[model samples]
Target: MRPSGNAVPAARRPLAALDEPVRVEYRTVHGYRRAFLRAGSGPVLLLVHGIGDSADTWRDLIPVLARDHTVIAPDLLGHGRSDKPRADYSVAAYANAMRDLLGILDVDRVTLVGHSLGGGVAMQFAYQYPERVERLVLVSTGGVGRDVNPVLRLVSLPYMDQLMHLLRLPTTKVVGRVGAAAVRRLPLDLGYDVDDLLRIFEALPDAQSRSAVTRTLRAVVDWRGQVVTMLDRCYLARAVPTLLVWGRHDTIVPVDHAFVAHAAMPGSRLEVFEGSGHFPHHCEPARFLGVLQEFLAATQPAGHDTDAWRRLLRYGRGDGATDAGAHLADQALAQSHRTAT
Candidate 1:
C-alpha cells in the first residue's frame, strides 16, 4: 500500500532540490515517540541514518526520491528529535524498532538504504526479517570489517561518558565550532566529513544522548575495533539485491571494508565515490541519486521465498553446498581478526 500523504508533483521540481523541506512526523511506539519523514507514493524506500544523525540527514535526497517512491526516513531511537532514554541501543534492537515503525506506518516491505551505523542496522534487519526487505543499499556500512577510526575506538572505551560531559561546556562548544570551521577550510578528506562529525560531537553533550551513543558504539565496537562482522552471512545477498556504496577516502570506516564486503557478497554492486569521505550521499548527491535510480531501474525487487530462506539458512546458498559458504565465512572472520590484532 502506498503511504497516505499529499503527493508532490514530479514534473515541476528539480531532482535534488536542497531548498525543499520535508515535514517531520511522529508516531508513538513502546511508550516513546519516534520522529520520521514520510513522502511520495509508490514502492517503499526506507532511509536509515547513521548514529547521532536525525532524519534530516536525507533532506536533500528525500525530495528527489519521493518523486517516484514512497520514502520513509526515521530517526532511530535515542537520536534526532526522537526521545532519547536509557534503553537497548544495540543494532538488533534498532532493527526491531524499524520493523515496528514500518508496521505502524503500514509498510510491509522496503528498499532499505542505510549509512554508516544505519547500514549495519539494515543488514541486521535483513538478516532478522528477510521477508520484510526487498533490497539493501549499504553506504559506508559498519560490521563488514574490524578496522575503524581510532576516535570511535576511544569513544567505546570506559569512562568516555565523563569526557563527553566535559565537552558540554559553553567554551568547549565554541571551541568545537571553531575547530569544525577551520577543518572545513583545510585541504583534507576530513573536511568533507567535519560537519557531520561536528553534529555528532554536538549531540554528545547531552547525558542521555551520550549514554545512548556509548551503548550503541560498544555494542558493535570495542577498544580494538569493530567486533561484528557480516562476512559469514554475505552469501545471503544472492537472494536479495544488494548495493554497496562507499567514499573512496572514508577515514572513519575505511573504504577497504567496501572491497572486502563486495568480494564476499556475490552479485552485489559496489560504487566508490572518488574524492568523497564517509558521507558520500551528502558529498555527491547527484551521482548518488543517479546510481541509486539506475540500480532501482535495472533490478527487480526480491520477493521473499519462505522455503528458499530456510534452505539458505540450512545450506548457506540454497545450492545444497556448505563448503564454499563455510570457507568464505572463515576467510571473513580471519580477515577481521587479523585487522583487529
Candidate 2:
C-alpha cells in the first residue's frame, strides 16, 4: 500500500487494505450499530469524516497510515452503515459519541484527525476531554470561519429538508447524471466536488438517511451561514500538538481560514496543497501521507495537566484575558456577523 508519486484518487475503492485486512466492525451505541474500520497496531489514529460522507472517505489514506499506526475510521450516527436514529447531530453530540465509542473500544488516547465537519467534532472532542487527545490534525475543517459554500447554507434552511426529499425521487439519478454530463462538457473547471455531491444526494434513498443529513446540516449551519464555531476555544489547543492541512483551491471552505486558525493556535503547523481542493488527502495522497507521518514523528504526544488547564481557564495566561482570549473573543464576534449575502 505504498503511495505512488502521481496517483490520482479513484472515485471509489473496492476495499481499503493494509498488510492485513481492513475489516469493518460494528459497536452498538445507544442501541444503534455504529460501523467502523480498524487495522494495524501502534499509536491510535482516529479518522473522522465530514458531512455527506462515511468512514469509506478515508480509504485513500488509511492503508498508508496503517503502516505505522492503528487507524480507526468510524461512520458517524446518521452516516454510512451506522444507524441513523432521530438523534442530536451537533458537534458536541458527535464528540460525545466518539468518546463513548473509544471507551467501548478501550482506546484512551489517539492522534485525532478530522475532515470538514469532522474537524469541528474533533475540536469539540479535544476540548471536552483534552486528556484523550494526543495530537490534532484539521483538514479543510469547518467551524473556523463563516465562509462555507452557498449550497451548504441553502441546505441549512428550514424548508430545505422537504426539497432534499423531492431530490430523492427515482428519476433524480437520471437527471443528475445528465446534468453532470452537461457540466463536464462546459469549459468551466469544476472539479469532482459536484460529482461527489451528486453521489451523496443519490445515497439518500431512504427517509432516515435524508433526515440525518438535514438534521446534521442544520445543527452546524443556518440560513445566515455557519452558526457553530471553534475559533472561540482554539486557545485550548496551546498545549496540544496541532497541524492544519488545507487545499489552496478549496471552495467548500476557504483556505484563508487555515491561515487565521494557524495564527490563532500559537504553535500549530499549516500545510497548503497548491492545486488541490476539499479532499487534499484524496487528491495528493503521497504528499498528504508524507506530511502527516513527518508531523507525527517530529512532535511528542501531549499530556494533560490539570493545574495548568485550570489556571488558563481561571485567569487566562497572565494578560487577564487580554491576549489569546481577546483574539478568540473577537473571532467569535466576527462569526456572529451575517455573511450569507
Candidate 3:
C-alpha cells in the first residue's frame, strides 16, 4: 500500500561528485534498447551495477577511473534507462548479454568491475568467457556467500510476485516515502546502513521497474539467502587477477564474504573499508579508486591458454598457468618484501 503524498522520501541523493560529462549511448540488444555510459581511454574497464541500480551508480567513480582507463558502465536490462523486458534474468543470461554488447561495440579484453548483484554477473561473465576478462574486481558482490540481508531473502518468498505487484501500485510511493523517512531517522551506524535500501524503494515506484526488480532478485536469491554461489567455481578465477573490496558495515551482503573469498582464491587481494556500508565506493570513493588503480597497475592482464585450461581441468591444477598468475604471485611476494624491509 502507498503512503500519503507527503510521506515519501526524497530521490536518492548523489554522494559522489560528477564534474566531467560522460557520454551516454544506446544500442539494441535482443530487440531491447540498452543504455550505457562511456568515457576516457586506455585499458578497458567494464563496470556493472547491482540490481535496482543503473549506470548512475558509477557516476562518482567514473570521472576519475576514466582518466586512465576506458570506463564502460552499462544499465543492466530492467534497470536505468534500459528497456525493461520480460526475459531471462539469470546471471548467465546477463553475462551473455554483456558479451554480445561488447562484441557489438568492438571492445576486447576488459578489467571487469562489478558491485553487489553486478558482482555476481561479473563472475558469471568471467566464467563463461574467461578469455575476455583480464582482471576482476568485486565490490560488495553477491554469489560469494550464503548470508545476505533478510530483506532480500524476504522478497524471494512464494507470494512475493503478488506482493511486488502491490508495491507497484500508486499507494507504494507514499509507503516508500514514509519508510524512507523512518529509515533515515534511525541510527544505522550501530549495524548496517539503510541509505541504499531506501534508494532501492525510491526507484521502484512504477510497475515496470517493480516487476524487473522482483524477477532479477528472484533469479539469484530466495527466502533462505543467496541461492547462487561462486565459491565452488572460484578456482576457475585462478588465472584471472582478482581483488575483493567490502564495507565493514554492509548489511546486505556481509563483509565476511570478502575474507572468505580472498582465502579461497589463494592470492586475491582484499580491502575492507572500516567506515563504509553496503556501497563502499559511494561511502569511500578515494580508497576504492586507489585500491583499484594500484591493482590494475600491478597486475598483468590474463590471456587464456586452452591447453593449460584443459590441463587444469584434468589435473586439478594447471601446470601451464598464465603469466598473469605468476605476476600476481610476484606481487604477493613483493608485498612480503616491503613488510620485511
Candidate 4:
C-alpha cells in the first residue's frame, strides 16, 4: 500500500527538473568553452552521451535517475557545449576532457554512465581512473570491440572526417541548421516514433543551436580511432557494479554489441530494449526509465533511504532484441560521488 521514492521521476517529476540547461563556462586544459548540464542531488551520476548526441539525448531518462542521483551530463568537447579544439579529437582526448570537467566540479568519484561515444569515454575513464568510478553503465557504447557496421566504416573514414571539417569551415550557420535537421529527421524516419524533435532541441541553448550540428558531426567523425585497452582490461568493465542499456533494433551501433560487452565483462547485466532503436531513452521512455531506475536502485545503498517505490525498483531494463518486450519491470539498481573543484 505504500510507495517508493524513485516513483517521482517516473510519474510526477517533469523532465525539466533534470534538463535544466547548465551554462558553466568551464574550459578544457587548453581553454575552450565547455558547457554541461547538472541536476538533482543525491549520489553523483555522470552521464555521457553517444556520437551525434548531447546531454539532450538523455532528456527522457535523466529526470527519473536524477530523482535519486545528482545527474551530471556533459556535452563532450566538440559535441554538445564543449570546446571544439582543432587538436587531437580522439577518444582519449574526450576522456581527458571529462576528467578535467570532473576536476573542475571537484567530482572525485561517480557511477559513470556513457552512451555511444560517451560510453567509450566512460569505459576508458574507468580504466584510467579505476578508483574514481564506483560503478559503470555502458549504453550502446563504442570502443568495446572492433566489429562495426559497413555504414559506420564509411562514416569513420579519414576522408569523410576531412569533408566534415571542410563543410563546417565555410559557414556553420545555414550548414549547421541543415545538417542538424537532417540528423534528427533521418533517425526519426528510420526508427524513432517521436514527432517532436523540437522538444529535445529546445533544451539546447541558443549558443549550442549555432554550432551543435556541424561540431557534433565532426566530433563523431574525428573520434574514429578505437582504443582497446579498456576492453582488454577485464577489471575495468567487470570490476564495478556495471549496467548496460541497449536497444535491440539499434542499427547505428547494432544490438549485438550489448552481448559482446556482457561477454567481455562476465556477469555484467544487459537491457536490450525491444522495438527501440538507438535512442531507447526517447523511443521507449516508460520502459527505459523503469529499467534504468531499477538498475540504479539495485546499486543504491540502504538504511537512510526513504523512497517508498524504492522497493518496487525491480526489472532489468533490458530485453533480447529478438525477444518480445516482456521481460521488463523488476528491481535492478546499479551503483557514485566525487569533488572536481
Candidate 5:
C-alpha cells in the first residue's frame, strides 16, 4: 500500500542484496521459474526459503554448507526468476511445488533445511515425505503454536490476497522509488532492531521479490486454519533427526518458539544464537553453519542406519544430527556463503 499521494514505505521491505545465478528454469504448468546452485559434496541438502524471500536469501550461508553437501535451493514458484502464476499461493502449494521439483531433480534422500515460513514447510514436507528426508533443520519456524511473531500476524491475516493483487505490480525500481519515499513518512512499527529497520524495509519493490511477499502472505491465509494445526500436531508424531535453531532476538519469529518445537520433538536439540534476529544465517552466519554442519554430519549414514536417528523417529536409538561442534571448517566453508537461487 502506497502512502497518500506518493509511494511511501510500508511495513514490507526488500532484501539486503541479490544472489549469484546458478541454473535457472520455469515450469510451464505453474510458470514456476527456479534456479539451482550445486555446492560441496556428501549428502544432498535441500533448502527451503522463508516467506517474502527467494532461495537467494541463503547467499551468505550456502557456501558454508556447500562444502559438505550437494545443496539445492529453489526460488519457489512465484519468487525470484520464477514465474508468477495467477494462482497457487498456499503453504501446501509451496510444498507441492517443492515435491515436484525434487522429483524432477531425482533427489532420493536429503537433509532438509528451512527458514521462517520455509521451516514450517520443511516440517510439513517431512510429515508427508518421511522416507525421502534424511534429517530436518527448522530455523525460526511457525506451526508450533499461537505465539507467532507480531509482524507475521500482519502478513498471515486473511483476505490479504485481494490486497496483494492490488498492490503488487510494476518492477523493483518503481516500487523502490515509491517505497523509499513512503518509508520516510512511515514510522517503524516492527518491535525489534538489529540496525535501521526502516531503511532496510524501504528497499522493497523489486518486482519479483515484492510479488513474492504479496503471494505468500495472501495465500498463507488460504489454509482455513487446518494445516497449521496439522503440522503442529505432526511435530510430536514424527521425529526425523530434527535440529532446531533460533535467534534470541528474532522478531520475525521469536526465539522462544523453539521451546515449543523442542518439546514437540522429544529428542530434538535447540540451539540459540544470542542477539541474532530472524535471519540467523545472515546475522550469525558462522555459528549457524557450524551448528548445521555438525548436526548434518553427525547424521551421515554408516554401514547401518544410526541409532540416534532411529531414536529420534521413535524407532529405537538411531544415528542422526544434533551434535554440538567446536569446529566445522569444511562444512562451514560450503554452507557459509552462496544461496539456493
Candidate 6:
C-alpha cells in the first residue's frame, strides 16, 4: 500500500553500516506528529518496539526483512522522535494509534510483530481489529502473566517522576553509566541486558518522556507485577498464526511467561535464545531473523472470517464451552506451570 499524501518524509538515515539507508518519515495524526521508518516493498510487516524504545530497535532486522517485505516500524507516541504529549498511554490507546497510523498509510493488512510492551499493544490490536492482522509475532512480550521485572514495578510506583528527574542530573547520569559498565563486567545474565536497559534509562531523563514511561508502566504493572493479562483472550490466537520468541535468560520478563503463553495460545511456536536476556532480537539477530523468516514462509497469512471470529469470541474455539470456561482453564494451567517452575 502507498503512504498517503500527508505522510511526509522526515529525514534519511542509514539503518546500519552494511544496510541501505532507510527513510524516516512523519505524519500528523490527531495533531500529534508520529515518526516511522518505512523501507522496501512487498507484503507488509509492521514492527513495533518495546517501551522506551523507538523504531530503530529493529534496525538490524529491518534491513534484512525489507529485502523480502515492506517493513514499517513506528516510534510509539510518547517515545523516541514521536510527540510526547500528555495522553492516554494505555496499551489500548497505543493500539488505536497504530490503527490510525496504518490507515493513514493505506495499509490494509499486516504481519504484526511486537516486542515487550509493544506485544501487548499488538495483541490488543488483533483483538480489536482482527481483520487487519495477518499474523502475530511476540518477543519477550508483556501482558502474558503477572510476573515482571522489579525495576518496572518500582517505576510504576508514586514519586518516580521526581526520582526520574534526578536521573537527568549530570552526576547521576555519569554514575549510572559507570554502574552499568561495572554490571556488564560481572558474570551474570543481566550483563547481556545492560546496554539495552541503559538506553531505556537514558531515554527517560526528560520529564515528558519519564512521565510517559511511568504512565505506560502503571497501566500494565503495579508494585507487585503486571496487572493486565491476555490469557483470557489467547484462545483467539487459534485463528491467527502466532510466534513467541524469548530469551531463556530473560530477567525482565521471566522466560517462564513464554512457556505459559505458548501453552495458552494453541499452535503458537516458541523459540528460546539460551545466551540472551530481555532483547533476544538484538542479542541473537541472525537466529532471530532465521526463525522469523522460516515462520513467515511456513504459515499462510490468516484471512479474517467475520462469522468464524464471532463464533470463536462467543463459544471459545468451538469446543462446546464458553470463553469464560477456557479462561479458567488457561489460568489454572498457567498457575500450575508457574508453581512447577
- Please tell me which predicted candidate would have the highest lDDT against the true structure: 6
Better of 4 and 6 by TM-score: 6
Report the C-alpha displacement of residue 129, candidate 1, in angstroms: 1.0
lDDT of 5 by residue, 1-341 (tens): 43321111233222323243334344444444556555556678888876655666665566666655677887766665566656667677777777888787777778878887788777767656566777788888865544455454555565654544444455753675556566446554232332323333333445555555666665443222212532223432244677888878776555656765565465677998874666667666667777987887676431223453355456422222223221221232232232111
Residue pairs clashing in model 2 are: none
In candidate 3, what residue range of length 10 has the lowest lDDT sum?
A: 332-341
Q: Which stretches of candidate 2 lie over 4 Å from their true place?
A: 1-18, 182-189, 317-333, 337-341
| Residue-by-residue lDDT tens digits, candidate 6, 1-341 | 31222221122122334464578999999999999999989999999988888887886568788888999999999888899988988888998999999999999999999999989888988988889999999999988778788888988899988988988899998998899889979998888787778777766647888888788788788887887777777677677999999998898999988877777777788899997899888777778888999999999999988888888878765563345545654764454222100
Query: What TM-score does model 1 achieve against the real structure?
Result: 0.88
Error of 1 at 314 (Å): 1.9
Full-model lDDT, candidate 4: 0.57
Tell me the tens digit of each residue's lDDT in model 1 across 1-341: 21112221132123556543577899999999999998888999999988777777776678888878899999899887788888988888999999999999998999999999999899889888888888999999998878899989998999999988888889988998888789879888788687667766665546888888788888888988998877767576577899999999787999978877777777789999996789888777778889999998888999888887777778865442245644544565786652210
What TM-score does structure 2 among the candidates reach?
0.88
| Candidate structures ordered by lDDT, highest first | 6, 1, 2, 3, 5, 4
Give the TM-scores of the predictions, in the order they appear: 0.88, 0.88, 0.84, 0.66, 0.68, 0.89
**Candidate 2: 10-residue stretch with minimal lDDT:** 1-10
Candidate 1: where is the Cα deviation over 4 Å?
1-21, 317-330, 335-341
Q: Which RMSD values do the candidates have, in order?
A: 6.1, 4.8, 8.1, 11.7, 10.2, 6.7
lDDT minimum window of 10 residues, candidate 4: 329-338
- Tens-place lDDT per residue, model 4, 163-249, is 544434536535655655676566443334222232333333444343444344344332432323243343323437788888786
Quantify all predictions' global Cα lDDT against the true fold.
0.81, 0.80, 0.78, 0.57, 0.58, 0.82
Supply candidate 3's per-residue lDDT for 7. Answer: 21
Cα lDDT over the full model 2: 0.80
For model 5, the stretches where C-alpha displacement exceeds 4 angstroms are 1-31, 155-212, 221-227, 230-232, 235-239, 301-341
